[model samples]
Target: MTLTLEERVRLFGSPIPEGFTVRVVESGTVINDEIVSDTKVVANGYDLYMTDKVFETMRDKCLSKTSKVWGEAKS
Candidate 1:
């Protein structure tokens, strides 16, 4: 049962920020030959993901740019 953190916040009707992805995950680390585990959910280690809306928006913005930064990108 994997639950993402963003949904919890969006459940309250607050919009997520643009160009950013937020999520929570289980993490752990080893210290002094002992496994120090972070059982609490957190964000790290590529647990983050891009929203479809943000990806599309970024693609559109890149396609719309004509400043040569996009290198003649197709529409």
Candidate 2:
């Protein structure tokens, strides 16, 4: 099922998955390209955005750092 940004956000806090750190860069604009005048602006009409580089880095870290020891122990 396709999950909307709000639904996903409800299911998972931020765009960054659990157990990982995310570095968000404020481009001073919303994901829809609207200029943000205030830092207090919540993600009302916008989705939390991140650069491709950040996404890739998080993905790589999660994949590489997953423990294989749990599987070994189970077996």
- Among these predictions, the greatest lDDT belongs to 2
Q: What is the TM-score of each candidate against the true structure?
A: 0.27, 0.32
In order, what lDDT does every prediction score? 0.39, 0.44
Q: Alpha carbon lDDT of residue 6, candidate 2?
A: 43
In model 1, what lDDT does residue 26 have?
Answer: 26
Query: lDDT tens string, model 2, 1-75?
Result: 875544444566343446554335454645455544334322433344454455565455443333231232211
* Cα deviation of 55, candidate 2, in Å: 0.2
Structure candidate 2, residue pairs in collision: none
Model 2 scores a C-alpha lDDT of 0.44
Off by over 4 Å in 1: 1-43, 70-74
- Candidate 1 TM-score, C-alpha based: 0.27
| Range of the 10 consecutive residues with the lowest summed lDDT in candidate 2 | 66-75
